[model samples]
Target chain A: MALSAFILIEVAGDHTKSAFKTIQRISGVKAVYTVSGSYDLIVQVETENLQTLSDLLLSKIRAVDGVTKTNTCLVLNV
Target chain B: MALSAFILIEVAGDHTKSAFKTIQRISGVKAVYTVSGSYDLIVQVETENLQTLSDLLLSKIRAVDGVTKTNTCLVLNV
Candidate 1:
């Protein structure tokens, strides 16, 4: 089954738009929404499994230009 | 503009299914997905505005039978 998750992102400086665009283009990201609260955005992601989910977060999401923090809430089912 | 949010919920005991069903019926709850990690479910909510969102969370969602905790991340735009 595919792994699904929601990533809560915190961007640094004035990079919300740029970071949003970059994060949306990532291969496994399904949807990205700008939100208000403790975090700036919510990203819905799908991956092959736990390993891929981790790699996607570390190598892709966190690598986005202004993404300073990420908190992932993994979906339990496919 | 409508207010949107993702509510992370924590269910108590064996009430996941029951809590999910009850929550889905609430007026402003748009979608609900069972998830793992720190939260048990992620509920997509849409309300008329911030005040309505607050009322829904405080008066409805928190009042669900098995919902022990709720963390709301309100969507920015309609």
Candidate 2:
């Protein structure tokens, strides 16, 4: 089954724009938006399974230069 | 300026679909999605400002049949 998740991200200093640009270009990232509040960005990602989701987070998203923190909210029903 | 926010919602019982359907039709609600997380659904809303956003949430969103709780995360940059 295809699984999806929304990742809430926090960046260091003022790298939100940079992080947004880089993240949007990444595969699996269906949508990315820069927002305020506690998180700098909210990203919607589509993946085949949990494994792929994990890899995308660890290897692609979290690996971004300005990304400081991340919280993953997996879509359960959809 | 137009302000947008993502509202995280929790609905009563199995009313997610019902709430989703109703919420999506509301004036200021740009998008609503059913998901599995700390909150059941995530809704994107756009309005003229915080006051209008508040009015939409209080009058339209909170009035939905199954909606029980809501948390708003305002978009800062975008």
lDDT of 1 by residue, B33-53 (tens): 887777888899999988998
Name the weakest run of 10 consecutive residues (lDDT summed) in model 1 chain A. Answer: A69-78
TM-score of each predicted structure versus truth: 0.87, 0.82
Candidate number achieving the greatest DockQ relative to the actual structure: 1
TM-score of chain A of each: 0.92, 0.96
Tell me the spans in candidate 1 whose CA falls farther than 4 Å from its real position: none
**Which residue pairs clash within candidate 2?**
A36-B76, A76-B36
Error at A17, model 2, angstroms:
2.4
Native contacts, share recovered per candidate: 0.74, 0.63
User: lDDT of all predictions, in order shown?
Assistant: 0.86, 0.88
DockQ of predictions, in order shown:
0.61, 0.55
Backbone atom clashes (below 3 Å) for every candidate: 1, 2
